[model samples]
Target: MKRELKVTSDGSKTLYMENWDECYHSVHGALNESMHVFIKNGLNEVEADSLHILEFGFGTGLNALLTLSERGGRSIQYTALEKYPLSEEEWNAVAYGRTSEERVAFASIHLADWNAPVEIESGFVLKKVETGFEEVEFEPNSVDLIYYDAFAPSAQPELWTTELFTKCFQTLKPGGFLVTYCAKGQVKRNMKEVGFEVMALPGPPMKREMTKATKPSNV
Candidate 1:
């Protein structure tokens, strides 16, 4: 698995896998994509003093770093799941941070021990879990928001099934949301089948649509 670092449109870096022809984030703009899809649309929608965020693919730790930048006064507990954890050299090569503070925060997020909650900053706690998406189980209704940053259905069709969305729906609390960069018709239908009220939103960069699924408050 050979990966190379490439600069995105927004002047941010992303890891591109040569063999799979996959990128950790969008080529249009890694920073722009994350800020638009995950932070602006996903995180900002959750009105909470304390947020428990569960992320599917912790590739590059870009979303978490951006969340740290936008957390404001909220206390955030971020749990990121990754099966094949990147090495120090790999994450170090993908420089996603700009300022001195953000650079340090990015390093702290990656250096923290796996499976243990580490307070990366005053208002942010990070826990990196080393496990594949299907292998782990979560306590029902445990998460406040989920950043479903998995590869496209084209790359991993098995992950986009109703069974996985059912697990995602069950794991989210009432009124919680699941935001993803994918808006495939089948994906939205699968989410709806598992009792999620799905919404189609404008996507970032060159994409047309994104999906935001909600576990209704009355559920």
Candidate 2:
């Protein structure tokens, strides 16, 4: 079952279950936070003409949409993992508002087929993997960036554990960045245990801090 959630003062659409809330995009402004973390901090530093990106929770396809819009000079192979994905109708109801340029970009993401990789535009290929995070398999040292935007630790503790971080660390190339809105101490410790150098940074409004973990070249 799918239900709309009220996030933030702007009343952006968030998805929720009995206790779990996913995707802060709607409440936080999708494009705004994505650009800040992924584009500014992660993707901009990737010098490769082609890059592979992995996102843990592909809610509303907001990160995918924003990334496609900003991919000017490089080709991106984007893979997103979602277990209980939103239906097409549910996805449509989420308003992207009058942001014509971004709205147009966002529309293309939902129209893409699941599992089968689709080229939404030149230099941007998106593939939706309808599997849980634990079941999904990624090639070691292949991913350039990881958007670890799962629910909070209280809601989904498994996603924040050392085992999960170990899997994520194995998937990333040396120097790749893992960016998430979570700043919990346990999450940081898990990342460190998995060989990531964690950094705490300022978060969006109403949030105190966020975390960015980087895999070292030697690891």
Q: Tens digit of lDDT per residue, candidate 2, span 1-219?
A: 546655544445555565455544635655556666667766776788899999999987877876776778689999999988887777777655347977776787887889989988888889998999999778889999999988778878988989899999999999898998788998899999979999998876566787899999887
Q: Give one digit per residue, the lDDT tens place, for model 1 in 62-129.
A: 99999999988899999999987888999998876879989988998889999999999997999989
Q: Please list the Cα RMSD from the true structure of every candidate, rounded to 1 decimal place.
A: 1.0, 2.2
CA lDDT of each candidate?
0.91, 0.80
Q: Which stretches in model 2 have alpha-carbon errors above 4 Å?
A: 5-7, 10-12, 21-31
Error of 2 at 217 (Å): 0.9
lDDT of 2 at 23: 46
- Evaluated with lDDT, which candidate comes out highest? 1
Error of 2 at 94 (Å): 1.2
Estimate the overall C-alpha local distance difference test score of candidate 1.
Answer: 0.91
